[model samples]
Target chain A: MADTPPLLKTITIIGPGLIGSSILRRARQTGTLAQKLIAADCQEAVLHRVTALNIADETTTDLIAAAAQSDLVILCIPTGAIRAVAATILPHMKPGSILSDVASVRSSLGPEIHALLPEGVSYIPAHPMAGTEYSGPDAGFATLFEDRWTLLIPPPGTAPEAIALMEAFWHRCGARTRQMTDQYHDQVCAIVSHLPHLLAFTICNTADRLSADLQTDVLEYAASGFRDFTRIAASDPIMWRDIFLTNKDVLLATFKRFEEDAHRMVKAIQEDDSEAIMQNLQRGRHIRRGLMPEPQN
Target chain B: MADTPPLLKTITIIGPGLIGSSILRRARQTGTLAQKLIAADCQEAVLHRVTALNIADETTTDLIAAAAQSDLVILCIPTGAIRAVAATILPHMKPGSILSDVASVRSSLGPEIHALLPEGVSYIPAHPMAGTEYSGPDAGFATLFEDRWTLLIPPPGTAPEAIALMEAFWHRCGARTRQMTDQYHDQVCAIVSHLPHLLAFTICNTADRLSADLQTDVLEYAASGFRDFTRIAASDPIMWRDIFLTNKDVLLATFKRFEEDAHRMVKAIQEDDSEAIMQNLQRGRHIRRGLMPEPQN
Candidate 1:
């Protein structure tokens, strides 16, 4: 049997942060993602750390130069910075080359980036549905994407071959891949990821605003539920800030839905309506249980 | 050196559910909580399970009989049913015997239960800040209370000796005990436990109410944030319902605070106020990081 060739000749990953570094580590370990892996970040400190880690064939602050030499360039920056960074690097990307990103939100990103895409370069945005509260290059691991989903959201009129290659690329990095339009992606992500994060962040502030004594006690006696919320709340502020602003419409709609449901719960409790409260609680529990994977014998 | 006597000569646990069975298991394992451990439940099946598990010295379905022979009787039932069960068993409790409960809510319970207290019988209510999403006798373990807080809320003018003995009892069960007023306990719990559970339950229902396709995708791609909320939402519905209704005022107040904070977040995102969003996210991250225990070498 003939050996399968490497996925790409050279791939440059911009912004070597948590997700970027994890992908680089995975590519270096597998030795099949690309023959040459380039790590590019505007920050000298990040490049220094990338060099020290030795996960990339080359580390550079010159994203344009790296883009000019690569068959694929994945932007691992914040959602707010994707367009500006794409515009700066797209002109140098070769024709038929692929440009993708790992931004969490995808509301207007598709059309905005498509407007800036070079004539023959393909832009296929992807979101790897895996992360931790911790960030930065030092916090990444090779298997961070294992068994996780990487949703592909390509703009309209993009080449099918580019999307297929990106899917195969993510699969090689140990992630399941699915393709969906940007609108659906934002809506699903709003309920599943964005809204939960907003609630986590808001609840932490609420707890922090309590009286000094109560706040101290709340921290000292933080229960499992509160601790879980706090752990989610500890994610990177700038990254989350960008996500919230980019997916504002869907996120706000979801929050309104959650708020109405919460008010219903409050009314049930206030009216001493045990049956209504029980029904709502049961529905929540049932829905949650249904989401669980079946246990294997 | 003399051997230390048991905390109680005979102690009965009603309900024999998660917390109750855990206490029984710990008592059986340590042989110091009580000289004779009795498990009583209205359901014969629960008592049968307790017997089968061999965590209790005696198992019975007769609450009155169990109370009549015990020096200490702890009601490990739902908050809404605590008063009625205490009223039923209080009449049969021996004189000078201590009666306590492990209800999650404390609002108005201290006064109400104190009103039904027979002469010379003490009532102390405690809220153990340890539990899982699971319930029932089969979902318990001996070390469930280890290093967890059990806040004791005794009625005004209660005997100090009774309070001391109950505190010691919980200590032997491997829980740290603290005494506080019912009002304070309710307030602390509203933020630390009840409010978080309320949010978790409400968010699950909100996601359930989404469009069919979106709902399916939300569950299929449930990320860490949503999964955490679901884990919390999967808790016993009946137990949570009773807690919400019992602590109605405090829980509702906390929910209001949380709603206001959430609205503020929505406004920040709507106005595209990155500074405000960044500040709130940073505050949440800072508060959450502060709650983490220091790393030991």
Candidate 2:
């Protein structure tokens, strides 16, 4: 049997942070993601670390030069910087090359980036549906995307060949891929990721604002319940801030629905209506258990 | 050197659920908490499981008989049933025996149970800051409380010797012990445990209430953030319902504070106030990282 060809001839990963570094590591370890892996970051220190780690075929601080030579360029930066970074490199990208990103929010990103693309350069945005509380190059591992879903959002009118190639690329990096419209993607992610993060972040501040003595006790005696929230709470501030603003409409609507449900719970408790409370709790428990077979932490 | 004697001659655990069975298992394994472990439950099936597991020297459905001969009787039942159970067992409790409970709420529990104490009997309420999203006898282990905090909320005039004995008992069960007023315990738990569970349960329901297709996708692609909340929401509904009502005032107040913080986050995102959003996320991340040395999930 003949060996399968590499997914792409050359791939450049910009802003080689956690997700980006993990991709480079996977490509190096598997020897299948790209024939040559190029890592580009604005930070000299990050390039130094990538070179020292030796997970990439080459490292550079010049993103435009890297984009010109690569068959694909993935912007693994924060959501706020996606458009500017895309605009900066899209012009230099090879005529037949693809441009993609790993931003979490995708509501208006598709149209915005679509407008910036040069004639022959195709764009496809993806979200890997995986992460940790930690970030940066040192925190990544080759298996970060293993068994995780990577939803690919290719703007309408994008070439089918480009979409298929991107799916193959993610699969080689150890992810399952699916296609969805950007609008639907935003709504799904709002409930699954954004609202949960909003609650976790808000709860931490609420605990911090307690009286001094009570605050000390809250941290000291932080039980399993609060501890889980804090784990989710400890994520990159700038990245999350950008996500909140980028997906503002969907996130706010999700929060309103959650607030109304929470108010109903409060009323049930206040009225000592055991049946209503029990029904709500049971539905939540059943739905959760049905979806996730194993409990995480 | 002479071996130290068991903490008590007989320790009767009323209700062999998760917490109750865990105590029994610890006592059986360590052989230090009690010389004779008596397990009592309203359900005969639970008693059968306790007998089959051999976690108790004796298992019974007779609460009064178990209390009459035991030097310590701990109620490991729901918060709503604590007062009623105490009322039933106090009259039959041996003279100078200690009666402690493992209820999470403590605001009015101290006074309400104190009024039912017998002449020579002591009442000490304890809240173990540990659990999984599981219930019943089968979901327990001997090390469930290892390195965990168990706050002891003794009534105003609890005997020092009695308090010390209960503290020693919990220590033998692999838990650290602290003494706090009922009011303070409730406040601390409202922020740390009760309020977290409330948010988790509410978020699960919110996700469920989405459009059918969206709900399906939310569960199918349930990311790490939502998965953690679901793990918490999977807890026993009856147990959590009782907790919400029992800690009504503090839980409600904490929820209000959290809601205000969440609204502030929404406003920041709406106004596109990047600085404000960044600051909130950073503060939450900082506080969370400062308190927990390691992430659980």
Candidate 3:
């Protein structure tokens, strides 16, 4: 890679949490940024952690001040907090700055954030469908985005150049960016990420109270496939709670589909239909074969 | 480590398939046998794979004669096939040789297999909780058992020394052994292994006809946790069919519990109860945290 070009203008991150700090780390590492890298977080601990990683060149505890001095302000926070933070930071934004966010539950906040943004400031919504079970600045790594897809939910009328620049940035961050409608993004995520998390969380909680002997045996025999679900269910509780709360409708829809499908199998088993059992098992095999290659950890 | 003592004495293997061949591979690697090592399969091709892997010094189509010549005759076949195989092999077994069978669904098979054994042959049931999505001799590897658990189930009046010897052999083959009653083994596995496989199979199968665009999204987002399920669902269909067929009652019971749990959560989401959702997710986190210290793979 060639040396990074000097900053044309500064980029300010609204919350230098895990994904936020990691984005800074990757931007600098990939030589995509031309000027300054600044981070603004309400928590001093977050500032310290980001600075300690040397991913940010400057830091502050004020979102407005950070927005006033930047060409781009990236909101990287919880789904529940995106709207309030955007409202606070919107007034202080300079004209022509491209403001964007990295939140998973896009549809819930997209319109609200769009409504609050000052004229001439772009609200380009993006969600990187990539993460590990860990969180926080210390847990973030430059390579988290490698080979993962970042869905960009740019509002219908957002300028082409603003969307293109964001796509270029994601590409440099090592993620393949796919432009998507806000509705499509939300529904797809509900099936692919949200509902799966709910299932993992539900099963884990249920199995936890079984006899100690059975519990140990459950974990031991988990090599059969349950262990993978266990790994996801192990993710930070608060982040997931916020996700389930915010993406309620889409997740509920997917869960309904899952329940109907689960019931059919249960009925088949009760009746001892070997053909039904074999058909279901074979179908699972095909999907397993169809799912894309996973990134080697 | 000291050189292996070649403790095996006329070891015999019945139904020399994937697990059989794998056990043979690692057993030879550790030099665990005291004398001759023999493997037999009703299928000529299976015996050929055994000889090619060199786990068998000799192979035969006659399972009974193979049983008569050995100190230990391992029934390395499906959960459903063990009883029939044992019925034929036990009749020709020589007195005093310990017999053990490797079948994942233990509780249901234990009594049946024990009843069929010859008067003098000691019967110890065992299941090595290790395998890949792949099967057959080409998939066999000596390291498959490395850091894996091999569970042993012994009937009443079985000599302790006989169990100890087999345990030691598995340890040498790079596996840890756990002794448990047949009933408990089946109950634990129904939730941890069987239910998970059925679930994975169903999810994969139902989503197979997903639109091209949805399919792409599924693959792209799989690293979020879905691919692990895919790998499990990819396991041999024939073997899984045998497991569900033989362990119908236990699996039915397990499926009921899973449905009750899944249905409760689906209702919680439909009702939009934050408290219920949060509780389930947090419980999942707790259970998953407990599983972290164990060897997941």
Best prediction by DockQ:
2
Q: What's the best-to-worst order under DockQ? A: 2, 1, 3
TM accuracy, model 1: 0.96
* Candidate 2 lDDT score at position B256: 89
Q: List iRMS (one decimal) for every candidate.
A: 1.2, 1.3, 2.5
Q: Candidate 1 vs candidate 3: which has greater TM-score?
A: 1
DockQ of every candidate structure: 0.73, 0.76, 0.61
lDDT of 1 by residue, B23-102 (tens): 99988888888899999988998888888889898988889999999999999998778888888889888889999889
Best by TM-score: 2
Docking class of 3: medium
> Which regions of candidate 2 deviate over 4 angstroms?
A1-4, A294-297, B1-4, B294-297
Report the C-alpha lDDT of model 3 over A1-297, residue by residue, as the tens digit: 566564338888877767887888886676566478898899998898888778888889978888888888888887778888888888888888888888888755777777787889888977888888777777777898989888899887898988888887787788898888877787777777787777777668668767887887787667756777888888767677778777778777777777677777777777877788778888777776656452221
Per-residue accuracy of model 3 over B35-140 as CA lDDT, tens digit each: 6778787788877767766776888887778788888888877766777777777888888778788888875567776777676778887788888787776677
lDDT of 2 by residue, A173-279 (tens): 88999999999999999999999999999999998788888888899999988998998999888899989999999999999999999999999988999999998
Give stretches of model 3 more than 4 Å off: A4-8, A292-297, B293-297
True contacts kept of each: 0.81, 0.81, 0.72
